[model samples]
Target: MLSRNQWLAVVLIGLLVVSQLPGPMVHSVSSRPAHLLSTLLTPLSQWMLSAGNRATRRPDLLQRREPGEDAVRQLRAAREEIRRLQRRIEEYERIRHRFGEQLEAFDYVHAAVTRWSGDPANPWLEINRGRRHGVAEGDVVVNYRDLVGRVVDVGPGTATVRLITHPQSRLEVRVQPDTADEPARHHLVMVDAVPRRGRFEAMVEVDADAPIEQGDIAFLHVGEHRAGRGWPEHAYGFDVGMVTRIEPDQERLPLLRKRIVIEPFRDLPRLSNVTVFVRREYERPDDN
Candidate 1:
């Protein structure tokens, strides 16, 4: 424990020693502590920078996934729209064809079958077109393949057609013999009625000398007279039925009455729709 004057002298000597030190030595010593602190904090600073970069990019990744999901949904919707457009195109094509047929003086009317008679023997079809659509009794109904039937009854917007195979229906046909000399000279054969069974038979009358045979093609004539001497006049070819067999009846005199098995041109059982053709001309007895 020195006196007050001795302590003051020691403090002054310590200050003078520090003030006389070289500037380079002081700077080097001072920088050493800062360098040590910087090395220690380097890894923590780098870790914080890496974590912030990941946090910033997370929102962009989520946005990318959302766009990918939306693209998938849009692709599916586009496929369905293409299918709907294709169906509409098909319907338009069908209507266009129907219009062309009507404009060509074919006298055609398109009608969809709404109902069918339950009885297989006496078959009939109810059509969507009726008197309101120019559909009347005796209007011939046909399809792209062949004739179907004739309208029998009419309502405001609906009509019923008697099928070709119905018992009451009789199609006057010209039997073109397989060995005929000329197709124009072939006379008329009455397709009387449809048999209940046994190969779907029908009736026809022919002169005993007339060339008639099985497997002949029977063609239906709409407005033709059969008893003429020359070629058929005022006739329209509508149907083709195959003759399965022909059996002559001996009891019938000079004219041979034969039972002929016939099949229809169009399968009436599968008919869905048909076109009705209105006959524009009338036939006289002496037309042929």
Candidate 2:
């Protein structure tokens, strides 16, 4: 356990003691004791030297092993983060391509829906765009294939929109009857109003003798429902939905307001991207 310098001093003391011994006594001691000392000291000296070498080399040797493990872990984490970001970029590219073709037909702003109201009773969605993106409070929002909702509130960087499933949503809708070769405009009707108790559906009150069926296609905003019977009339029209479930109320047969439920053309909750028209499009002369 002695240090290197201490071991050297011990060796010097043994040599001094040997020199003081009488000549014949030294020779007699060397015959047995010297051999014993050689046997003991050889391996002990080698082991001590080996331990000292390891101690002196430990600082650099330990530095490489521990830091090597940490570096590997950090590299693996950085790779995973890069993969995640690449996936997000691919998603944005797909969304851009899908929204491009339909947007060409109209003057509109695109937005990504960032949030949703889980309540079917008061359904809504939030878009990561606002007035700064040219989206006004009353702008119409639609997926490429069909209507989604209307912008209700606007912020600097975000906007709140009311989806059609909301209890208070009342966009005018028109249906094409089953057996009618009649022009699309002739069959237009204001959707009968009802309390949105559950599920997404529009109750259309039609005549009992009318040829309206369960599979008829429907349109929204085609004709102008109400500027509240007092406000200025605005022009807005778009393809809305289709008649999926029809129930004729026997109690209202004489009244000719038999109710039918219209399901939207596409499932609204599944839509991720939508275009919001900045102003009511007055392009359709018939809508006037």
Best of the candidates, lDDT: 2
Enumerate residue pairs that collide in model 1.
none
- Estimate the TM-score for candidate 1: 0.49
Off by over 4 Å in 2: 1-106, 177-185, 192-199, 224-235, 254-257, 279-288
What tens-digit string does per-residue lDDT give for candidate 2 at 154-262?
Answer: 7655677887766676657657642223334236556643434333578767776676776666665434334451111222334556676776576657456567777
Q: Which stretches of candidate 1 lie over 4 Å from their true place?
A: 1-106, 177-185, 195-201, 222-235, 250-257, 278-288
Cα error, residue 80 of model 1, in Å, equals: 46
Give the alpha-carbon lDDT of every model: 0.57, 0.58
TM-score between model 2 and native: 0.52
lDDT of 1 at 275: 88
Clash count in backbone of candidate 1: 0
